[model samples]
Target: MSILAEEQIERFFNVLNQSSEIIQKSKDQSYLDSLIEVLDTVQSGDVQALNLAKADTTAVSDIYATFNRDDYDSEVLRKAIQMAVLKAIKVDKIQANYQITPDTIANVVGYLIAGIFNGHRQLSLLDPAMGTGNLLTAVANQLSNSIGVKLSVSGIENDDAMFELAASSFELQHIHAELFHEDTIQNVLAPMVDVALSDLPVGYYPIDANTKGYNTRSTTGHSYVHHLMIEFAMNHVNKGGFGFFLVPSQIFKTSEAKQLLKWMQGHVYLQGLLNLPTELFSNKASQKAIMILQNTGGGAKQAKQIMLGEFPSFKDQTAFQKFLTEIDDWQRNDLLQ
Candidate 1:
């Protein structure tokens, strides 16, 4: 990032922090709640945020004035909000699943999406497990930049705080996305989209009754939420459309893999599984891989050679570039054809 961009993000973060602190103190709300209110205040210039906080109008106005939405691009705004969200996560001791997806991972997902849908003039995207809207906005911003394509974005989030944060983030970024604040595993209605992306929440889904009819749902006990979400996401993807998920590196080795594989056999085509650099995680259990899948029909078929490999450490520029080149070659020679 350029020095100016870094300075701009810091400036915006400072404003967010100041406003959040004022609100948190007055309303006794959590940092995340206050931050959402601050973002809303900045986006709509509404006095409701001020009145709710019972904060002095002049002080709050001065803090918010330092931020000019026009001054920063969507990516910059995203990064600034990401920084603030990270702080709020720490302050609130949010759960592991609520953590924001890293920028590096989001960038990789964007690259894969661009490659899959290259030359398309327009696209629709869905994120069934969107948290804070960071990954969704990041990928959308990248697609707009890389392909100059018009985009329709949609996301689903069950958490109240995350839903509000995502809604505010999208509005602030000028991204007109359809957002659903409901449990994805439930009967949430959404349009079939051209592409879907998710950093799947890892754990067991508590509701056993909702597991009925899902091919990947376990016969006993709670079903793996990640597996259920993958099925749910793929169901909403238009035939031949792609879905990219950040899944546990050992996803296929899990006990539930048999059911997941069974579902894959009848529905989507597994196109690729690219393991992110191990160095990115603290241990093997925590590592994630990007799994690419394509819905059946619409002429979609399995590639002659599946794209599979471990990315080199990001610090190793030469190896990383070579891996990306290999991905490009695979897409051109096998997948796209």
Candidate 2:
């Protein structure tokens, strides 16, 4: 089933690639009219006659030629249609600044975190930096597949394009998800979550006067927004909640980050820090680490120790699988003297 689904998705992408030229050439109104017709047909459940937007005769023929491939399963086609809507936002020039989490890593993170829950059927999960909702989808997929129950998923995305794409993707997956289009630092949500996950953007954000009081670490100083986002995710986790953040490993080496890391240790039980492969991202300079934060909440309690693990590379499937299998045991280890 999975193989057939993958093939169909590949073929659908081919059609989109072929239609790229026509879409770029068509007049604005003509493109809109053509798109409306295609949408209307599909919404009416007419899959057999799925057609590309009415462009030039040559463009239409090119799309049909690409679509008429070796058909193995009709099931894949329906899934492809829904995915097409989300994949349409991949205009590289427009979205170059965005760093999308790869599907494999996202799923791995989601599955590992979901595995931590023993009997929790109803879960509240949050992703403050959810881009196109990939992280949310991955985590939710793992949770639902494991416990046979839907999750109350919430996400915040500041990018307008990402916000719309994520909303459509959630609808297609039939996930009961709430997404917001607001800066995470500015507008805070009211609900606390059981789990929080984010692949935060790498940059420094100037602390605005109004939002300067959000974190106690610094009032008016410029801080790594990535660190602030991680703090934001940690703060939103309910007492005893779990959070997973993908950040640069340099957070452990820098003087400023050491203070924040010390502060984090004082608050949450730092479960694990696994160094990801440097080449995992398009930006090879990004040395990433996955910090698993288990919020014990405030008061006199302090974490006994934090588990530290390093992976030279994630490309080794066998070694990576072994790493994942031992996570539960890794979390139970006492690193404090």
Candidate 3:
């Protein structure tokens, strides 16, 4: 079920838009006040709110039930939509867990939009481990506001509860999905997706019986519950398609993600890396990384290495400029060709 009734929300949008064209702040606040009234009605868990609002139950059925009415606000709604859109982008690594804090969602969403808007082809999105759909929502809002977010998205998640929540979130927003209740890596067809993988086995044995051992690690067997979340970003993303994803932060900093990085390098140009804030994760291991990749059709030298750096720790759209400056500085240095 949608958190806010769609008709009610649409009216708010209509009013909000009308107010935007005028200079009167009170005019906008009038519409905003109406929106707040609706938010108040829809925020409560009481069936009365659902019934009275007469919301589309189909869309409202997911996380709305879990929403603490007291928490209902513009920030809450913005966060929910932000998370939903970003988790649906197409990439080869990581899945956004809805368990992620609202602050993290806000920060990532801002950075994602900032870092990925330089190209002209638009973007294709994916989120393999969509929880309550924070990432996808964020991506959608950013793209709609950005100059180049014209791509579709896909996703997959094995957790039934999470899958249901994600599906509901997407439907409410009039967004389509190809989400599946399956392992992310096992299935490859997607606008985008990720599979959780576990148990890496490394061997020093010779290749077959003909070559010397090359010290390789392989995930030939993926446990049903433990598979690498390989984000396959393919929303018709052309050769230079770009992706910004929040996977297990260790995928870039630890031995676990090291090989995956090497594997990833063979497929896409690794752009910048942003060390994520430790406070954002639910897990004790707060260290994480944001990866940027671009697929270059094989006509020139594959990128050997891309820039890696820190992003600002802010939630406003204004922070985007800080990132652009960093990227600009990197490019002016001829760091990326």
- TM-score per candidate, chains pooled: 0.97, 0.76, 0.55
Full-model lDDT, candidate 2: 0.64
Runs of candidate 3 exceeding 4 Å displacement: 1-98, 101-115, 118-122, 192-227, 231-238, 248-253, 279-284, 298-305, 312-324, 331-337
Looking at candidate 2, the ten consecutive residues that score lowest on lDDT are: 35-44
Name the top lDDT candidate: 1
Residue range 1-337, candidate 2, lDDT tens digits: 4765787777764554444335445533333233323333322334234333554544546455545424523334434533444344343333444445666667668766766664676888899988767767766776777666557989998877667656655654567787888888875773689889988887767645534654524443666777778788888888878888987877767556764766676568777787777677557456678887888853313345565677646678898778776665544444212
Tell me how far the alpha carbon of residue 326 in candidate 2 is from the true structure, in angstroms, after superposition: 2.2
Angstrom error at residue 53, model 2: 9.0
lDDT of 3 at 71: 35
Off by over 4 Å in 1: 52-55
Sort the predicted structures by lDDT, highest score first: 1, 2, 3
Residues 219-274, candidate 3, lDDT per residue (tens digit)?
Answer: 33222121133323422245655555554455545444555555465565666566
Q: How does model 1 fare in lDDT?
A: 0.91
